[model samples]
Target chain A: MADWVDACATDDIEEEDVIRFDHGSRTFIIVRDHEDNYYCTDGLCTHEEVHLSDGLVVEATIECPKHSSIFDCTNGEVETPPACENLHTYPTKVENGRVFVEI
Target chain B: MPRDYDLLGADAKSAVANGLVTEDWYRTHLDRKTMKALMKRADQPAIWDTVVLFGSMIAFAGAAIALMPSWWSVPFWLSYGVLYGSAMDSRWHECGHGTAFKTRWMNRAVYQVACFCMIRDPHCWKFSHARHHSDTVIVGRDPEVAIMRPVVVVRMAANLVGLTDMWDGLKRMIRHTGGRILPDEADYMDPVFFAKTIRTARVWIVIYAATLAAALLLQSWIPVLLIGLPRLYGCWHMVLCGWLQHGGLADNVLDHRLNSRTVYLNPISRFIYWNMNYHVEHHMFPLVPYNKLPDLHEACKFDFPAPNTSFFDAYTEMLPALWRQRKDPDFHIRRQLPDTANPYHDGPARAAA
Candidate 1:
């Protein structure tokens, strides 16, 4: 069981904002949804390698910046073409106003 | 008189022989009227396009030789890197569409010559490029888009690690043409291949090999610069132009028209590349000669695909916008959705019939 690594402060990302955080060989996109829930998913589009952090954060979904493939930030399901695979999500927790994600 | 009915049949047959048009296309697009028009335009380069191509290549080649002395003997590589490589992408592009000549053999002949001179295999390119036109920027199935993805990735990665021209080419060719991308077990349908593929590959190898051998015998770095460096640069330019013109943009529906692209209007970009930046018009009517693209784009601005906001604007933002466009992917073959299921998703239009 990997322990949560404190990724960023709640203030690090605003609602409708996505940022890239590298964890080993894998990269994760930390997106703050409209409801202020912080979700983490694979940072790269599965179909193509465009970074998820660079996408448009719309409500609960993040649209990839390159080809507009949508991904659910909540569970990482692919919502469009080009990308057929679901993005992998990391368990996220907020403690003491700081965001932490389990790699 | 009467437009040579036998010649039309022969031309269509030849186009089929070269894999320029599928049987269905022959039946659908090449009717008597269309065939007559296609013949009228065949094998004869539009005076304007020919002048632009030849003049651009010569001027650029001369400038490159003066500037990069090592590139003198094979200056075509440098000029091609600029003029033909980028702008004139549609010269061979037209050949792929089988509109370069009324006679299929003549078109194939011109394409082969152009491909060899340009160090590209028109036949091989046609196999992939034709699919590109048919499929558009479909991520997995479209080979051209698939081929370009890694390069786009690396370019984005450029901030972290620098990319040389050769490294870029290697990455692209490996993904696109290299057998690694092939699915297990070949799906063989048509047994015959266009002469442009294998023949062009062989000639390219021979010429390049002989050039290398001579360079080695003479013990001069000139060969490395002439044949090698420009190819590296030329191929990179080719891939970039091809990639940006369609791949980076959101895919356009088959019917609504695709967005045309324009780059920095460097003289090199224009003269050498043959105004292919007017891509929307080119794709809309593939048979329209390249020389006529600009006028067409300008005249029919409302009908053609919208030009990108600005390639420079996109450049400044870098790959983010391009990457963002991924979610809204578009395919070339426009279907009415639920009427006739997208052939791109369902599979080839004709399933081994």
Candidate 2:
């Protein structure tokens, strides 16, 4: 069984944008791709612990503002170095116009 | 005695103790929407410019090769070198900031190309530039200070032909390839980038070695001329334009208006320099794209000192100031701002006011 928490409304994140979702002490980044799909991953950049939400989403990749390391939003895979580690991806779903992520 | 400008030297420690490092610097106010508009990045301008730049480089190099061993070859090669070596400096700078293009990959591609042209290690220079923006012209903290007081005339002259920069760049690349980072570089660079920096250096060395081997195998200067050697011959304009940005300007000041110069240059120079002639505006708003710099300048001109009328006018003021600074290290060019401009409120200027 997975604990799925309500992150935000479906309309909260626009295309090519990201929002930071905090549940208790944990934080995650929810990104909206160009196709309007939502994906969730660990919030911090593996390179320098910078918030990925502060960065820009280009196509399907989220570029870290600090050092420009990019991660694929779809798979939380490291697409660029300086960040050699892939982010942990969480299961995300939209139900009844609300976005939810399994933590 | 020559002043110590080293980032890890006593001067830097003194700057920290004197409350210079990481202190809040003055900024001209911009409306939120206007600021947002200026920061907006676009790919069209960058793509168009990239096409033009590379297109010009290829055309010029072709002309040079066709005219080889003739006096006509000199002009074509010189043009190619300027495009490759000089213009690449600004391209490297803008792309490194990641604000030149809306697409991340596009910026990265241009950055890599410009990095190779300028002989800069992308990983190291990227972090160094971030620090430069964070602590602009802060004595002891800034790694990119071009002209230190008691100006070293001979060294500055040597830099005009790229002798100094190329030698230093080679030394740094060798050191990086050997798995060593300078203490000053280590001071500001994140430890996470060290391995990547080394790897990049190794790649650059291999490329250069290959180019040299190609030239030796063919017994022709063409390979070197097209690749590594152009940086030395074509770097004069870059050094010339770069010195105007901050040479003889105020140092250790919290206001960029005091520390940086914005000179009006011709369209060609602006294109080559990528609008960095608006140096103060760029420093003030590092996120602003190069295309929007003129707009940013227009928006904030009231708060800034008047831009130099032209490059010649800027050098007229700068040359004499550099001359005086050689005798008096404390001397600097204090620019006159318009009455409409806000007063600079840093250091002694504030107390005097």
Candidate 3:
């Protein structure tokens, strides 16, 4: 069973941007790629705790500002270190243009 | 040669005896065949090791995320390991000197790996580190020894506290603040070389940045922070290792015997650090691999410049010793010319006067 949680409204997010959302006690970065797709990933970098929202989004890849650990924004797969671990992904979608993350 | 004689002559032995050599069960790097074989180990920059280094970090990051912890205190060991792995480029540097590898191309390849990993140009580092070795502690000449003044350290401290270490580091990327005076026959000093270095270094920075971005996309920021912050810490260690290893020690003009200082250190330090604690020996030969340092230390323990003066002692005793004076003392400073008994006044003089 999929448990979809309402994360944020459409107006809450800007285009081609990422915002860190605190779901429960844990934090995750919610990004809208250039394709206008919504994605949610663990907020902190796996290699270090630099905020992913603070990272640069080049196409589908998100680059950590600290130490340059890169990750695939869509699937949360690691591209490099100071990180080697894949980012845990939350199933996300948009309804009425509002982003929703499945826990 | 006798085993005992070989042992006695080896630097590793002195390293071991002094407790600076690490790894209890080390194959004594004595005898020509053994020496050659041990030296060959430098050639074994295995992809497996690199992969392991790469994979283990990923695995660690994953584990950290699964069992998510508080932000107040997070483990950042993996970051340190990543930094250490990158800094091992310095080791590749030693190899590039042809001290690590017998084959020149092999050494170049190793250096290239280091260059990519650290985001610094291998050729540039080779030239820089080489010059540093040739001119140890020659003020305004040696790039490595051109320590940031106390004021700079304070400025850097403010920047770090303000979360701008990276920014400050970035600013320094293009500027060559150190090494005002160039040595004679400076073969490596060229504009083209520096341009290439900057480009290579830029590529390195990009890769590192991309790696961080990937982690963020993967929702592994905690892991990146935990695993990556250690790199900064490791950089601190590198500085300490370099500074304490050579700083405030006997600074000689030409004589390796009278100039260098050796630390008779504990084995744990040597083991983790690969006998680099015996830095005097390293700077003297630069060809003797880490494994062979013990043997060399044993042979040259009683020779000039003395041995077994702990860096710890210098930190504890000498910090006050130097601090009391405010600037680095001329404890072992000497002049190359014939006029003065010692080129540097030994007992006491105004600091930096």
Candidate 4:
């Protein structure tokens, strides 16, 4: 059985922005792209464990605040150096003005 | 031999014990909104500047090559060198921080170009600079400390022509190409990036080898002139500005006010240096973009020592201090802050006067 947890209201995240969603023991970063599409990835930066939610969401990537290593919001693939590993992405869905992430 | 200046040396353990590593330094207070505004990234200014800089480099190189075998070529080469070797340093620095452009790819592209021009490995210097910001001027921690006290006059003189740094960079690149990470680099850098660092070094080696081959095939100095040799001649301005950054300032201090210097340079210098003349403010607020630095300086100047009126004024103060420090390693410029500013920590003994 898959767990789909309601992270936040879709309106809570503006276009091309990210918000940290803490659901019980799991933490996820929910991002809304410029087209209003949603994505879910591990909340912390793979480089230094800094919260990716605190970083900048530019274009389709999230730039880590600490070292500026960028990760693709779509697939959580690392697009830069200093961070070699790809982020674990979760399936995301929006229903009735709410964002849900399947973890 | 015990190299006390090495970041991974035994002194590094002492620095950690003394609470220097990763500790927060003193910062001037700015409202959150103001900070947010300053930290905002933009692409327009950086795009415009990059085009101008690269365009100028092309123009100068073209002129130099066209005028070759004539004395008229000298000025063109000189102009090319300053733009490539000297100005690229600031671009390398700002782009390394990833604050130069709003787009990540743009920043990365410029960083690679500037790194090659300056003969620095982007992967290595990136982490090194991050450590620099984390621990500025803290002896045994800051790898970028330009002057190790009881100043080595010979080394300093060599650096005036970029000899020391260029030689060091080439040697390190060669070592890195062999897939051998220095013990000191391994100390601060994460192990996972080591393989990538090695790969990057290999790529850089190939590019340099190709450049050399081009020069050999052409039987002209033009190829090396366009690539490696400029680092020696055009580097004077870079060395000049770099020395002023922390030359006569306090060392092993947590307060940037006590360690970093801020100078007012001419418009041309500011453009080339990317407003890093506001060095103290940049050190304190590393997230702020270069374009916003002047405004940030305006906001924070009340809490800082007055900016050195001009480069000449700064060098005048710094030269004498360096001369004195040759005999007294404890010697440093004690900048007087305005009354509104908070007093520096460990005040009495560290004050210059």
Candidate 5:
């Protein structure tokens, strides 16, 4: 059973930016790509559990700010290491002026 | 009876019991926008530096070989040695972080070259250094702690010319060529890189053997001097710079301000060192590119210890402290932070957060 939760306003995240979103005990990030499409993924890097919200999003990839591990923002697949695990990507949809993620 | 630094020994267990394993060291607060800008990767600066590094090496080596049998060739070989031995260390570091270039493969290529030049095993050192950043100088966990407590004078002295490091590195290479992950290395490194580490070792064996064969067959010191010997002859600068990093510094601490040093260096040394004289800033923010470290230092200097302005100041502060530690392993020089800076420890403010 998936529940769609409102993350934030579409304007809240600028182009090529990520913002942290917390629901209950779990944390995820709402990422806005260069094309204004919004995506959602686990908020922490799988490598060392550092917050991925602190990471840099370039093109379609998000790089871990600590160790420079890279991951694709869309499907959450790791593009580089010391991180061998893929990020868990959530389904995202923009509703009116707000962004909603299926969790 | 001083502290032990063995990674798998009793000190390691004590470090874990004491909560020094993977600690969240203090980070000076920088807003998202500023941090993002500082962490942004660029290819141009590294590209330019790499071009000059290789270009000068080529020019010097060419001149040295052409002017062989003359004392005039000594200067050329010396210059080439520094470029090969010392400069490659910084390259190995920055590229290992994958922050030297925006392109992934570019970083990998340079990292491989620098690792070879520095006589370091790539995958093994990559994991070791990652642990280094994580633990800094924690006695039992960090493998890259330079000049560990109760420092061995002979080891440090021999490392000045890259003697012990190269010798130990050769041994490791041969061990890895046996297709076995070292027992200590297996402690932290993921097994995914095992095959690559072995393959790299095999490749290195072939290259070194070829170089040796060339020198033997040609009846000349040229090939050996150009290839295998620069690492030994030119490693002085690397060891010099590396010693000041955590020498006489606190161990088992979560604060890099306590463990790392920031020194002022000359233009040529800075160029060769890739501005790693701003080492505290690099440890605090490991992802920041080497080119942007000076700026990071400027932004964060207020909340940190003052920089050492000369090698005299650095060595004078470090050597005596290290000497004292020879007898009293607990003795270390603690730098005072400015009043305006936030304490990087779990003080009242951090406890509240």
Candidate 6:
């Protein structure tokens, strides 16, 4: 059974930003898109596991800083080359300014 | 027998079997905040560098064209060639990594421009370099290994002036015009990009043809000199600095310190090479942008072998290694890790001793 785990405060991540969140053992990212919608995805790039939190966030897509592999944070779908596999995403919720992710 | 460096050959399979393909190399771990700061991208440094590079190129080219047919123009032409022929290699590299500028389009724009200047098909080289980083110095896996074992002295000497390199580039470009990818290239290239790779080659042929036509119509060597010939004339700097990157280092090593060199270069050469003198650092944390390489080098310098003090120092060390490798292919310059460095985090590399 999946439980909504508190990832971070909604205000902790700025708009159009991503912050790394480690829950138990797995690492994920809390991304606040340009429209202020909260999203969650695996923090490591599918290609080489370089942290996606270090990557450039352009609206909805996060570009890998190492090789420029881009992915849609919303769906975790790879949007670029050199990285064929899509990322694993989690359902997220915002409750009273705190962000929770069902991983 | 000499080791096979062919990407599709036996050693390619060996690299896979040996667990050398994309194995995690040792890193000097830093906090996420620090790493994020180091990886942050900005546009100003790249903007200033690009403006200076192109601005000087235009000045030199204009002066050279005006003074053409006179020996007085030689110096200006040489300067122009270094910018167009040699330095563009670094631009192609940095922009290809998408770290040169914060804006994605800017990196793409410069990458395409640099690819044309270097006579490199952008897509082909992009994938080639991606593989290079993924499996650096692994025999038969890394296509960009500059000096393969037994050190073909003749080929190395010829490439100083880009004779063999440009010749091969021309041949590759010709093959690309026919919409054919070399079988070896196909091994690592994604099928998704094959069409655009061929398209890029076709576009280059048109551009080169136009430059040649202009020269013929004007009854002058000016147009070709401005375009195609510079890659031959001014490629010396590229080869000089590029060879020092991994010329005599241990091959098939999972650790970059074992296979890459960091040499101190003069400021002018650093500018020309886009700070790639920090070779080991660049290979280790490729996410770090070119402008931030010095900072990254500082952060991790304690964890690796000390950088060569100078170009002279680097070559002095490499020359004898190369000479010996010609006799015994397995003989290589073993890197001495610093006391603070963690033990080499890798499987036993062949002949690492």
* DockQ for all candidate structures vs. native: 0.01, 0.13, 0.01, 0.22, 0.65, 0.48
- Give the alpha carbon lDDT tens digit for every residue of B158-219 in model 2: 99989988998999999999999999889877788899889999999999999999999999
Q: State every prediction's TM-score relative to the real structure.
A: 0.49, 0.82, 0.51, 0.83, 0.96, 0.92
Relative to the unseen true structure, what is the C-alpha lDDT of residue B70 in candidate 3, on a scale of 0 to 100?
Answer: 50
Q: How high a TM-score does candidate 4 get?
A: 0.83
Instruction: For each candidate in the order shown, give its overall lDDT on alpha carbons.
Output: 0.51, 0.85, 0.51, 0.84, 0.88, 0.87
Over 4 Å off, model 1: A1-103, B1-80, B100-106, B117-119, B146-152, B155-189, B194-200, B235-240, B251-268, B313-319, B323-353
- Native contacts retained, all candidates in order: 0.00, 0.04, 0.00, 0.15, 0.48, 0.48
Chain B of candidate 3 achieves a TM-score of 0.63
Q: What is the DockQ score, from 0 to 1, of model 2?
A: 0.13
Q: What tier of docking accuracy does candidate 4 attain?
A: incorrect
Question: Could you give candidate 4's per-residue lDDT for residues B1-353 as a string of tens digits?
Answer: 12378876776877787766643567787864566578779999999999989899999999999999799999999999988888999999999988999877899899999998887878778888877876787778888988888877888999988999999889888999998998878866777778877888898889889889999999998999998889898988888999999998887677888898999999988888888999998888776899999999999988999989998999999999998888788888888889999877642223432
Expressed as tens digits, the lDDT of each residue in B1-353 for candidate 1 is 01111212443243334333321211012222332232234345544556666676666656655665453545555554544433334566665555554445654665665554444445445555544554354333244442232234555434122134345434433343332322200111112343323344555666768888988998865555445445445544555555456544433123213222444445455455555666655554454555555555555443333354555653544355456443422212221222222222222222321
Which ten-residue region of model 5 chain B has the weakest summed lDDT?
B344-353
**Per-residue lDDT for A12-93 in model 1, tens only?**
8876677889877878888898899999888888754766665556678876643445688899997643356789998999
Q: Compared with the true structure, what per-residue lDDT tens digits does model 4 show for residues A1-103?
A: 8799888999898777788898788677998887888999999877657677756676678877556778998999998756778999999899999988888
Error of 4 at B131 (Å): 0.8
Which portions of model 4 show Cα errors greater than 4 Å?
A: A1-66, A69-103, B1-3, B345-353
Q: Candidate 5 on B1-353: residue-level lDDT in tens?
A: 46777889888887777777763778898988888789888999999999999999999999999999899999999999999999999999999999899888999999999999887889889888888887778877888877977878988999999988899888889999998777779987889999999999999999999999999999999998999799999989989999999899877778889888999999899999998999999998888999999999998988999999987899999999998888888888888889998865732222433
DockQ of predicted model 5: 0.65
lDDT of 1 at B84: 41
Candidate 1 chain B: worst 10 consecutive residues by lDDT?
B182-191
The model with the greatest lDDT is 5
Model 6 CA deviation exceeding 4 Å by range:
A1-28, A32-37, A48-60, A77-79, A96-98, B348-353
Complex DockQ, candidate 1: 0.01
Predicted structure 4: clash tally: 0
- State the displacement of the C-alpha of residue B214, model 5, in Å, after optimal TM-score superposition: 0.2
Candidate 2 C-alpha lDDT tens digits along A1-103: 8799999998888777788998899889998888988999999887657777767677678877545667998888987655678999998999999999998
